[model samples]
Target: MDQHVKTLAHLFLDGEEDKALHFTEELLNEYSLMSFYEAIITPAMYYIGELWETNQISVADEHLATAICDFVISQIKGKETVRSGNDQSSGRALFFGMEEEQHYIGLKMVSESFKAHGYQVRYLGPNLSLEHSLIQINKFKPEVIGLSAALSYRLPGLKEIIKRFSELEWKPLIMIGGRMARKFALEELEADQVMIVKDLHHLSKWFEEGREGLINETS
Candidate 1:
């Protein structure tokens, strides 16, 4: 854990937006966008969530912290796109959360990872139905369909979505990520169609391997 990351989290929790942003910017100079995300920002977010879960902070406090974190990440996202060299066809991915699952920050960070690496990310956000997602998948025709479920209760919805994907003939690869996502056995759903990303580093590796597999299959 970077020492500055702990300070950043404390600033965010204290609702010192300007200082937090400044701290995040300073860290940006020390880390790549994804590295900052996977290290500092993500852990800061986890701490915020933990604070809320333990009743140490109010909902408004949590929301404010998240907003600050989101703003910082958006700043990095712009830089990423400019340096991506305009390769629009690197691959496409449709990202969404299960129905009634409102947690989107983690999913959005993952989407940014894809975008930073030149993948076209179609983010549908949270509270999406399987039917709706299927429609988007057909329209998007993404190489990957990414889903996230931040809460354990939403796992059923995530499972249902995976089931539908498995039943499809031309299903895209599925990548699941979130705090609670590790509780499930995603591999049992199907072969080469489902994966569980344990962290941002694993997510990076998964995209690399998944892209190679897609290329191999297509060629």
Candidate 2:
């Protein structure tokens, strides 16, 4: 909410990682990394996209903005959140992008939302091979595995990955979210836990409602 935080977030959106990191650390120390992200960074990203779409900024500038935001996000995610007081741990979730799908911003945002809702989020970063990802799933044993695909064409590859996982005898709740999932619809994916994302707020609300682990049964 502070003007300086907004300014720093804009700087980050404009691809100024050094300045963004400095400001992020200051605010994070005062508040929390999640607060800095929600209050400034996310809004700044939307603003940057708007500027680019409206021709106020160039494609190169938009890419630069994304780079800076990713850097700042890495910084924020490195900082731990306040521990949930509940003795019973909520389910663990893993988020990643399919191989050849370079976009990870959506995955990052959704992972943060899950974490805020008390899920242990294991973020595997971007462009991971299906084999490597399955190894991660086996290693971490998360209750949910979320794959994010930015483009629609990547859906088939994502499905292949899911099929590979299914063969492993132990399959986690596989949720896919992003532009592809939202537009193409999750019914087409045939995954047991697919959900269409209306927006970040909707995703957050869904996670909150399901934090107790009975969303499907109640519905």
Scored by TM-score, the top model is 1
Give the local distance difference test score of model 2: 0.69
lDDT of each: 0.76, 0.69
TM-scores for every candidate against the unseen true structure: 0.85, 0.71
Query: Clashing pairs in model 1?
Result: none
- Backbone clashes in candidate 2 total 0
Model 1 misplacement above 4 A: 84-88, 183-185, 208-219
Candidate 1, 176-214: lDDT as tens digits: 777665665545444567767767877765556755564
Distance (Å) between predicted and true CA of 65, model 2? Answer: 2.1
Best by lDDT: 1
